[model samples]
Target: MESTLQIMPVQRTSRNFGEYAEEAVIIEEPIIKQKRPLFIEANTIEASLEHLRNDCIIPVFAKDNEATLSHVAFIEVVQDAT
Candidate 1:
């Protein structure tokens, strides 16, 4: 006597949770504008010092609204003096 085995395919189903359904709703928040420190670059020491001068505006190169890393020097301005 010969015996044959039968195979069956299983179906997948997604489980729903109450917490996941609550998290699906997104709440929009108001955006607040804040002042951020900007770093400037210069070639020489004199040029770097020039950038540190108050009320001095320097040209900066950026791509896609972001600063690039190819600058020659970097300067950070401190608001509070100790």
Candidate 2:
């Protein structure tokens, strides 16, 4: 069966600077759709992750059925920001 994945905003930032400290600042914005990861649908989280890795797509996280494959949807992504 085919499925559809939802796309969301992924925030990113960059440092902007000119000739002086007055112009130095951090610019934050949502990542561009063109540069964002492509949505992929799969029956299982494992399969989805495998496909992402195989395609060299780095996902911040994704939604999938429960670990028991009970068809209960949930967010399944981990972030460890130091």
The prediction achieving the highest TM-score against the true structure is: 1
Question: Cα lDDT of all candidates, in order?
Answer: 0.52, 0.47
Across 2-82, the per-residue lDDT of candidate 1 in tens digits comes to 999989888998786765665457899999987764444333244455444544554546655554432233333232322
For model 2, what is the alpha-carbon lDDT of residue 4?
Answer: 89
Error of 2 at 32 (Å): 49
Candidates in order: C-alpha RMSD to true structure: 15.7, 29.2
lDDT at residue 9 of model 2 (Cα atoms):
100
Query: Residue 29, candidate 2: how far off, in angstroms?
Result: 42
Tell me which residue pairs clash in candidate 2: none
